[model samples]
Target: MSDASLHNVTHENEAQFGDYFALLKPRVMTLVVFTAFVGLLAAPVSVHPFVGFTAILFIALGGGASGALNMWYDADIDAVMRRTKKRPIPAGKVTADEAKAFGIALSGISVVMLGLATNWYAAGLLAFTIFFYVVIYTMWLKRWTPQNIVIGGAAGAFPPMIGWLAATGSMSIEAVLMFTLIFMWTPPHFWALALFMRNDYDDAEVPMLTVTHGRRATRNHILGYTVLLAVLAIATGFTSIGGIFYLTVAIVLNAQFLWGAIKIWRRDEDASEVDNFVVERKFFKLSLLYLFAHFGAILLEAGLTRYGIEVL
Candidate 1:
């Protein structure tokens, strides 16, 4: 390969600070940080403020590290997908090698610092989360199978577990329930996006469910998962993490989510195209709120329980 193609730093397309930050995928990191923070706060035991802060900071770094490594490996498909073509690497603002090095260094620092600040359990989970995202999800599953999001979702689900472990120094049923909630939510959330952006995956040859199974099958899958997710979300209400507040939130959010899924399931492909996938887009947006509200309510109940108020 030519030197120019070797991701040389001195190249004319020099990287800016923002470009490097973009490589960390700050948007996704926001969700990771928030959910993890909630998980830490919702644990049965209390954490010192400084220790909690350090743990969350390191967790965010681990999440960012995962994002950087994902970009490094997925730069090719990212370059071809219109939605991702503007990412740092494909846009020529950052080099793949730079991202890889940054990710590895951040991964090591984050995991070691978290272990020192919190415990080995949280650190071990964080390390595995990073590795799963970079290796299992990005490198292996994404390009190889239509079930990529279903299996790769585990990487995203681990943050709350890590956070819970960070606070209490051990795992609990509550933490596992939190992890399960995110795990189940991931499929329908992503598949909704895929329904509208199916062409992008097709053009990039990424083997997303929508590309392999067709929109009808994808729609049916969304409804099926949404049904299962509703059961899981409501069942969580009985867990230690759930309170009356969270149960109410879960019921309302799941109802709206199920309604959206039903609408998508009922829509014909011809009608969806004519309507510009309006229902799918709405469902996609709602899925974002669905996860946040559920986690936020959990945090709220945790706060209430701290003050001696009885929650569910």
Candidate 2:
């Protein structure tokens, strides 16, 4: 082959490799893996260490696949959005077709391998999670309504459920509660980012809450969900798996979260003060830790219980 053709082949091969990693959506995969770990530990049953690691790895891969397919399908909007513009497909590191194909291939492998390694139910949940994220959220809900995040939040909340299924090969009320914590957490967490990242959505023409409903309305909605989130967070503590450590963390963190929400709610969005953005940003930042800490506490409880210690 000519040098030009040789270069083209090399470029495609290199791009394909990048696209595969991109399909795993590394950052989001971290959260998925972490929560899945927490859920597995919190379960009444346990698996062998190696088997647990493999389950978490496959769940992480499935999450990444969903994210990749989302980016693949949403490449146009991603190209327009400042935050997303640097993503593999939109940045020219990978073509949309390559991304889509990469995402599809990994999605299939992750689901099937999870079934082989664990259970068909776990694999089925993984498949549905991928479908919900790529098709329901990225394709349909994203542009169709301002309530997108509220509804789309479900996509981000399935990891722990999958993990629980991996352990028990079935669902339980406690597992569902684990799912609920993240599910309810998604709206407020994402809406706060939407609060500050309005410009990106505006530029990309993505119908995010801040852009579609106006920032004031978005702020109200954020506060509303924050209340909902707080209720769920506190209620989760009273459930089967939560202990004193988890309950304590939940109460304190939810208090701080509620205070932040109230601050956002009372702020006048029309005012030109940076305070509005600062509080929302702080809350958004805290929301990240809020989740990580909650899951961490759950894992802590599991650890204590395993040692013949009780924190209830």
Candidate 3:
């Protein structure tokens, strides 16, 4: 659909509460919440259970607000993209104006509540995160540059830092390491998806690496980023938050991730299509586990330290 046609789209059915919830992009919100939670727990300072719960709640609200705003602004391209076509706005279940108001209201509520419940430092980070994702990434970089995910990934990486701040009311190297892990992991994770779904990006006119540079270059970039990601992930294991459990998880996961990236790098489009892009698909799935496992292991390390059973 043309952007004009998309703007004119109207719903024949009434918007349900589920439709509004879907606008939050709950699947993506899961990762944001998990990483943020891990960050909060891993901090040196202990937080009151209620205070911790409140902080995470407001942070998740901020993440949901960002999602709504992103859907509102990108509804035009989202309407054409197969992967995104069923979203609340693109599916005509919700109007862009509704999403915009919803997002703005949620953003304000989240920021203010977080500041009242936790510290302003964490609240400030949450506010910037919403702005970066909605304005910097979704609005400008996504359409204008192929390096969109590269620079825009910063928005996703901030949650952990915010979580750390909520607990400690300050930043630390441990928090920065947590942020770095996600920052470095984002490119290879999304690029692998782009390789398989290149057509969606092409049709939508989004300047993804696969759309702008072709699968070969995309594969190369994936391999390159995976190498760097491996370094960062493993190095994080030696930081204050790291323990034997996290180190073991990092080494094993990085090896698997690098191997998958190599498989993707070696395959051509013809071979990929003939095999249904299995390498890329597996790489993408592994990328998801790679991140979750790393954070889970970090949380485990923190739990052990509390019991005076630190694994060094």
Candidate 4:
């Protein structure tokens, strides 16, 4: 209504937009969107271009909203942990109230938009993904249990299945196997990071594997999950989506993964001192690539299929 009031309103609007987008957790959203896109495209049916775009957009938005909610609820731990310290809420780019409100709004909008653009099944899965991440994983499991990542991995592993359903309005065994590969992959990936960043979890009073069971146990767990992941990763080769390209990628990646796991397995994390865990940190980074490259190969294989190259 007046000049000072108008300026304040404009600033608030700008801040709100920034926080809303922050709720989308763009970095995490990128991975979700990319994998979801790949899954949608690789499916047996064709999705209209516009429909495909909209499904991926909402799926990414759902991911971001979950991240925002995580940041909102974990603001205390985020501030204490080095890895999460710079998130919107903890870094003060967005207030806790702003992030909470923003995350909830986007959560609703993304689910609703996805249902309209695709099918209710996809939208329902997206809704469950958000609830599981925000409520079950972030709020409950992370604080209460060392097996947090083990069970909570389901949230991160859902994007591809959501994409598959978005394309076909049904879930297939191929989608489930893709889900299985990522589910089995999650604990080892995250526990490797925890092996190195033990202090972060310790400082936050979170019962991460590194904190609750000790590094020796965590390393053994990593080796175990790596074996399970290796088996599933390779077995996927025989499934419908598997091709020569996918199988090749799986073998090479799993070999390197096994080598890294064996390295972690053989070495004693506690023997050399806390600093010796840097090897674990490097392995964690590699695990990130292990996922990206595996999915990228699937994309390549799908492309070959579309062109009728038939490299299966």
Could you say which candidate leads in lDDT? 1
TM-score of 2: 0.94
Q: What is the TM-score of each candidate against the true structure?
A: 0.95, 0.94, 0.95, 0.92
Clashing pairs in 4: 24-64
lDDT of 4 by residue, 1-312 (tens): 788777765343345566557666787888798889878987888899999999999999999989988988989998999988867677667788878888899999999999999999999999999999999999899999999999999999999999999999999998898788788989999988887776998999999998998988998999999999999988887776888888898999899999999889888846536667767877888898989988888778778877789743
Off by over 4 Å in 4: 1-20, 270-276
RMSD of each: 2.6, 2.1, 4.1, 2.8
Off by over 4 Å in 1: 1-12
Model 1 worst lDDT run, 10 consecutive residues: 3-12
Query: lDDT, candidate 3, residue 112?
Result: 98
Question: What number of clashing residue pairs does each candidate have, in the order they appear?
Answer: 1, 1, 0, 1
Ranking by lDDT: 1, 3, 4, 2
- Model 4 has an lDDT value of 0.87
lDDT for model 1, on a 0 to 1 scale? 0.93
* Candidate number with the higher TM-score (2 or 3): 3
Model 2 ranges off by over 4 Å = 1-4, 8-19, 270-276
**Per-residue alpha-carbon lDDT of model 3 for 1-312, expressed as tens digits?**
799987664546568999999988899889989999999999988899999988988899899999999999999998998999999887878999999999999999999999999999999999999999999999999999999999899999999999999998888999998888888889999999998886898888888989888889989999999999899888988887888899899999999999999999998999999988988999999999999999999999988887789444
